[model samples]
Target: MGNGVKAEIIAVGTELLLGQISNTNAQWISEKLALHGVNIFHHSVIGDNYDRLTSLFSLAQDRSDLVIVTGGLGPTDDDLTREAASEILKKPIFEDQETMRNIESYYEQNGQSMSPNNRKQARIFEGADILKNDVGMAPGMAVQKDETLWIFLPGVPREMKAIMEQSGFPYIQNTFPNQSPIFSRMLRFIGIGESQLEHELRDLISAQQNPTIAPLASNGEVAIRLTAKAESETKAKELVQATEQQIYERVGDFVYGYDEDSIEETVFKLLKEKNLSISAAESLTGGQFVERLVTLEGASSVCNGGVVCYAKSVKENLLEVPKLIISHYGTVSEACAVSMAVNVAKKLESKIGISFTGVAGPDEVEGQSAGTVYIGLYVDGESPFAKRFYINGDRDMVRTRAVKKGYELLYHHLKQKNY
Candidate 1:
């Protein structure tokens, strides 16, 4: 039998339509609902137009047992979710005295006067359960009518996340006692094409059911998301792990990090664990290499510093690369790349040094073609290593690929030491 509650997430916001902000709320709600055994069939994003929202709501009620809406719950006139919801369901709404008092008290606590328009936030559908919002002024709500449940949450991510975790999730779990536990693990991979990875795991994907293997490609990277459904989380995880082991036997070597692993984060972690410090001398990547490294916490422990020597003179003066090397081999040459790494490591007194110098372009530089990248990596107490790659796509693509390659280089170096 199908799960009793088939839910649909409706993100009501004009800005979402205009691409002013992503519909991240829908994604968050989907994950939350899945944990509560709520089946999310569709995700719909509609602007704040009342007529359109009413049509969307009617469709949702017809097909789904539960409708969860985020956004358009603000106090402004354009905040039309509640208005549209009230009209579509033909449910008369009144301001809950408790919510109104809370809103007033919030303003009082902050030493600010409440606007008359802010009173709109206190209104709820008659007989609906009021869900308090500890994060914001507008109170959330859960309405029940004719075997259908509607939950309204604020658009703000922090506010929506808090209310869902604290109130909405537990309430739904209690309401639906026979909910299955949802489990999934993402296997991240690099150094392989999606087509190639799929080809290797074709046998596994062909034979999936309760535990499913889905391979997906994003940007230039590939991943396999393994998911399972079972009565309990432990059983679900067992189901997933069984399939993961099978896939691993087939194509595990290509796998890098699991779930959400930023290339830089993985590299940084490895470098820190190994007690290795790195410095950078950047050219085409500008400061992107160092910028990405510093983005992670505890970067200072693993990074000495970097010199973004974009100019030929700066490379010679600041990074102290030999003038003869640049003049003879040009900046894009392996010699220049290797020298950039070695000299910067000496200058910063760091053990490991990495360098990115290349022609990324709408046009080529020196005699080198566009998308021609050379990276220099020098580990402390070891001879330096340099790799040359021809990356495809435009200027930004070339730069992005270069950064990913930089991470791959560091990861491989760390991996070799462990082995």
Candidate 2:
């Protein structure tokens, strides 16, 4: 395969298929393989059924150069990964004495006798390398059948990670010595849709090579993942940075933060940089905006607290939102939002104030449809204003998007002021 390995991760568990547990192992394995420059092309989740497991194993062997299977390695009858592998590859399964000794030693230390079934944890395919597990009883194993290499690891996250780190990665490096490592960076953006972001970078995506560009959307935000492969990390980074600079030249304004920087964290950082503090008056969002801000480190320095004024009386009395404005334009209106923002800032003695008032529901409020939201912002020495948005989703989704949009608005304003 020209020194490149095409890998597939197969997670074996009925719980995963039933949605009782997430297939997080596959995600973890894929990320690790990427660092080794292994191209992971497929991920499959199969139940404990022996026939289905063997069928999937046959298909993976035919298509992939390296196949990694996680889970189904326990001592229970339902654990069928090793059996399926043996059947598919026609290899005899034998117990490794080193692993059996370790398992027996563990039971001895626990003041108990080892059970007969526990020997299953020590089983390995003929002519395979035994991957020692320092964290658990099950020892992982790897075998090469024809052109395909198959690896079996425990389903338990702790044990699987230990084996992979200790033996799995080393074996892979030895096998694929000529493969170049990969480096990737995620550029996160707000105030833009996925299709629009893709359209803006169409040329770069179409002519992509070396460092490839991928657009992903999740939870009201879009991200571009730039991946590059090179002999050294520095060279890969340089390639990715060159592409990143070009993307910024076109859509930098919408780009908020890189990697794991959330909108709330971005806003908090801006507030810290500007030496400003903020308080919120939350309605339909129920203090969610302020909750996120307060969770960050050093939040006490910039967060002045907030008021969850869900009731109109609390808005008029607690936050001192003007009763006349609420009566004239309704509580879910721009006038009320502006009044709440300005008054909350005055009451809390903060340098900046933000407010959320919305109809987040399965029903309408005051002739306004569900998802009707008004976000108000008041910065000290600046005019207070409110923006209306028609968000779409259920109650929880509407509230979530409303909070995200609030952070987005604050981010843009702080960015524009350059404070």
Candidate 3:
């Protein structure tokens, strides 16, 4: 690869622009390209009109050395990428007999009659390399036209991903041997700020060359993506891992997860592994906390139930929070939060119970101001601990922030307790 093959993504489906189907394929391809250090210079989304598609293809050819196109490989009339590609490149399309036999056999096995247009699925460029679609009948192709390499893929997400992982990634690797592939690892950290986290690892960030550190913000959390470029994939990962180790040595405690690891996922994995279970009492979250936890597979083993005590009466009556305490301290107090947590665990028959109680509001409640929040955790044979925050945001933001803080505390507590 030469200076990491410059690439452009062209999504060829009118349905995408029409908002009928999302262009999820672009995101998948872009992430895959990033992993290999491919630089995506442009992302062009065009509809089914052949003239516009051809013009877009021509423009891509002039600007990028490698153009990745998704969609328009279907057997219907709207599927026009292959035809447009042949016309724009002046390459004759011919049926691949092997692919044709596979398609025919697929239809026969399903006991369905093949449509006349299905024959178009077997067509390829005059001297193009065929990419097999294991998940679907439509065969993808890689063709060279006007010094630009074009990679065509199906629009269906599963079909596209299967081909990319099994064949497409390898194909691009072989074709672009001169360009260095990009590789990256993301360190997911909670209970840390973007600035503070970087401050701890500023030395590593400032002194960078082959590998670079880029910090990204995600809803109340931060992920520092350590990207490294090298001719070999193994070398690139080694570079990333080395950088990650140095950073982790400084602030690994705040690091709760890694790439694609959400707080909920981390909680579920740890709980499942240790054969532990959890339940929640959501005052501000309204059962949202437990819903997020139990959404993962096998969560039923740990997650039993939850309560949404949006009102003082519910907290007092349903969760056994003393009505006298609420009358004195209101529903958003630390006592109320602790009670909610303890009671919910008893009610749910879970090993642990957590609760959210706060003024997640645009309006003040009782003596508390908007953004005033409390999170309580109650584990078996441990004291119920509550943390308070005075976050400044809108009503939804405050509630969401409070919910995330509860999980972060839960994650840290569980990690410390188990280890």
Candidate 4:
């Protein structure tokens, strides 16, 4: 078993450099490799230029024990990975008969004519182990050159993930039998800024050893990823959970969900549990707040209906916000938001109502600056209230934050009511 297997990722494609597509393959591969305890020392993105690829491959071989390359394995002229690898390994590319048969079968089964250039997908480097691609045409390869191991994968994310999971994982397990894997869990929090979350966990972050805490922030949310390394998955999770408990004891109030749990998901789950139904009235956020809720499965049971009161007339006429109020407060006020929330709940006969009214703008509206947002909430038989916020960013950012904030407030309110 290798004690320390340092891996380097080289993503090849001019599209990645031109921002035509994101280089998500590197990020995904890095996370997958971390699970098996392989440390990634570097990541590089190069164009389809043969010289540049060859140079990067050679550099990776010099410093890294394992080199993983993605892209440039297609049948097109610009797919230079195979040619570059051939030059570096001093090995000729040969057609693998079985791989060729698979490619032919794929085309035949799909009722498509196979192009002559498609035969290029079956070529493999000399003396290399073939990584079967069940999901795609190009077969991946693993070769040992000098002291380093080189792995080449397809650029398509689905094919790469499938090949790595089915074939690559077993190979890694065999190569690094004694290495401990890294396990991570992310705690998702809303209504909290990244800086504040980090500050609350400052002591834990500084004194970390086995389990490490990393805080990540997006448009309207923050997440703390707790990663722990251990021999077994169970042990690693236990370490992460212990660290998570300490975090929860401190700043858990702001936490709404765990890894992969969206605020809408949490809201729906809680509403369903409480046997409640919801509706929303939105202005600057448009229908985004309700759209998020209804996207989830079985959301109809908890989601009554919604109205996008984007215009002042809609807010005054549809949601019953008085014309005088819109004239005075300009539809972006707390009074307007409260009226929308209360009227939407009454009109839809829902147990709860949420509203978003804001200025998501490049230019000021009604003399109000951009990013001025107000969220209103009304639960059945409860007094309605509104919260105002001056969010920062562009129009889309303001709208997104406004929607998320509405969900966060509702979630907190539900929790407080023990519903």
Candidate 5:
């Protein structure tokens, strides 16, 4: 099939519905299936109820070409995947002799007698192909009924992944020999709101087709995912790259990195490249700003360390923020922030110094409202400056966003020097 294969992932478990466990199986399966050009249109989670499971199976049969169900394949009384599949397909359930032998062999090796209920794990729909579970007890099954091809795998992540890698993928490839492959790329952007980014590319998004564009926002950053399907990987990449260039032509300034690139990582790379060392004095953000920097490898070369001056006395004594500035402008003032940045850099003898001082709270400080933030930056050759920002969120959101904005500012400053 060319991109015509429609797939749905059904995660069967009460724990998933109850939020005791996440439905990561569907996510993993969807990502794998996309590599084979299978379009995953829907995801569903059903509790261990037979009627509801059968109903979902019936719906999958009508709408999807492939239905992959994970969980409920155990030997316990609550295990109902095989029973529901049999009921939906009007087929009889029979135990596979090969799987039964493997189960008995496993228990024999462990010096324990196999329980009668354990036979339930070997049961499969009539005429179904068994996908051996090399890592677990219950064998996965693949059976076709009418137009729908159903694959049942274990819910345990390790076992599910093993079975898919060993047998499930091979089975799908052999069945659908002419399948196209789907390739996708994520272009990450910072300093741009999701709404504004969408508005800027409204026309490109509206007229999207193959190599579809989708914008996703997460943790103060936005990403554009471009997915393309082609018979060859090269062709798919070409389609994705062409679309990415169009996006860059519009809002290139905001785009920082590509897939899996974090702002901190980008900043660290830039610092290393410029042979620059930096120090920080954190007030409202605590040590989070420096904490992020030191996590990266080779950070010792660029990071000179930091001082967390949450208390006003510490800012005065340790960072030596001028008492006159704090008395006149308060601890959260731009003047105090500048002193903190300049003093920390001088004390640490670094080329650059950054400071975060703000009121992150449900209450105001020194007449400044909550979410009021000031970021101070000092480069050896450039003048020290502090920018005031009014963010919108709770205390935690404000702190997190403030840290991100600091990275954005640093990124722009370092990037500008390249020209």
Candidate 6:
């Protein structure tokens, strides 16, 4: 029902302004509000100053019907959100007796003294609707003034989430029953750059309207989030899926999973479906590749295990890479990676094997530059193949990219074979 009502989020903290912390509260609240067809017009981050916050609040009330604020709800003088609201609304901060007793009891249960400052958390804007904080000491509040709704929440992510999920979400849902909820789905892709992927889907992105397509990139992967607003959840999902199909016609091969699926999870699912057991041999990526796989519940069924053959001697003695091959390829070549994968598969008696050998460094290795990576995949009774990559980033980034590349290679291989 609140589809056309505009909303503004104000994050109150000096830490946000100083760059010591991010204004994630605004991002999270905006997302939640948008899902219920609420329009967010502005995001503001203000320091712990009474005059400035009051002015910002008044500005928000002038233009927006919904004002959501986070932070400055702590038991300290710098926490000025309540004071600012009181001043702007011409109201006094009143103590809710039950809330004060609850605050005092919290300290008692923790074997600590309730400092006088702790009582400040119990004070609320006069006549405001109180939102009990189940997870923290400071409670939240919602107040209405002059056709605008003001939602005040704690700054802590944990407490804020709890209060919103417990009370705020229900309150909004009940108040705006006719809203066409926005639904979003994310399609994740690996082995592709953001620029290239967006270029391929440029037409779909440019012509988007009801269901909008937005491309985002982070670390070694790219994601496209499709958001659709419909009267019903089913209709919203259908709209998102229809747009997804259009994008898939162009760049579907690079998409490894949907929504929250990670590269490792996709690989694990493929291996299980193909009934193939897998092993790994590693160098620069250490045990990171296998370690991530094993975190999944059913990994033990398809994951035969892996070894971190970091040292040259270990590659020779443990994975049994031929001394001549290591010497000729200098341990970072496709030949060495293939040999490591082949030998590890045989050593572990797995149906499939993967290996990572790379130069992840601040300095060059074996005359090769840092971020030079090679990933090898060997299926039983088939020729082993290795992919080479030169990633850009620090040592950890190089290593992480190598792991993702390993999964991408395996996932594509399985897909090609109709697994």
Best by TM-score: 4
Which parts of model 6 have CA positions greater than 4 angstroms off? 108-113
lDDT of 1: 0.86
Clashing pairs in 5: none
Q: Which pairs of residues collide in model 4?
A: none
Model 5 accuracy (lDDT, Cα): 0.91
- Model 6 scores a TM of 0.91
Q: For candidate 1, write residues 1-419 as lDDT tens digits.
A: 12677888999998999999999999888876765567889999999899999999988888888888998888899999998899877788898899999889999999999889999999888877877799898878988767778889999999888888888887667666776777888998877889998888787789879788888887567888887888888998999999888888887767778987877888888888888889999998988889999989899999999998899999889887889998899988888899999999989999889999998987889978999999999877788878999999999988888988888777777777952
TM-score of each: 0.93, 0.86, 0.88, 0.94, 0.84, 0.91
The all-Cα superposition gives candidate 5 an RMSD in Å to the true structure of 3.8
Model 2 C-alpha lDDT per residue in residues 1-419, reported as the tens digit of each score: 11468899999999999999998888988888887788888999999999999999999989998999999999999999999889999999999888899999999999998889999998889999999988889989889999898889999998999999999988887877777777899999999999999999999999999899999998788999999988887888999999999999999999999987888899888999999999999999998999999889999999999999999999988988787888899999999999999999999999999999999989999999999999999999999999999999999999999999999999999998965
Candidate 6 C-alpha lDDT tens digits along 1-419: 34777888899999999999988888888877777788889999999998999899888888988788999988898999998888887778988899999998988898999879988899898888888898898898988888888889999998998999888878767655787778889999988899999899988889999799899998889999999988898999999999999888899899898987998898888889889999999889999999999999989999998989999999999998999998887899999999999999999999989999989999999998999999999999899989889999999999998898888888889988953
Residue 215 C-alpha lDDT in model 1:
89
lDDT at residue 289 of model 6 (Cα atoms): 91
Predicted candidate 3 versus true structure: per-residue lDDT over 1-419, tens digit per residue: 43747899999888899998888889889988887767889998999988998898878878888999998988889889988888777889899999999999999999999989999888888998989998889877888876678889988889889988988888887877767767878889999989998888888788888688999987788998888888787889999988888888899999988888899888888787778778888888887898888778777887888888887778878889888878887888888888888889988887788989888778888878989988988888889888888877888888777878888888888887763
- What C-alpha lDDT do the candidate models reach, one value each? 0.86, 0.92, 0.85, 0.89, 0.91, 0.89
Off by over 4 Å in 1: 1-4, 35-37, 108-111
| Model 2, total clashes | 0
Candidate 4 lDDT over 89-188, as tens digits, reads: 8889999999999999999999999999999999999999999999999989998888788889999999999999999878767755788777888899
lDDT digits (tens) for residues 1-419 of candidate 5: 33678889999999999999999999999878887788788899999999999999999999998889999999899999889888888889988899999999999989999999999998988989989999889989999889888899999999999999999988887777787877889999999999999999999999999799999998778999999988888899999999999999999999999988999999999999989999999999989999999999889999999999999999999998888999999999889988899999999999999999999989999999999999999999789999999998998999999999899999989998952
Error in Å for residue 353 of model 3: 1.5
User: Candidate 2: minimum summed lDDT over ten consecutive residues — where?
Assistant: 1-10
How many pairs of residues collide in model 3?
6
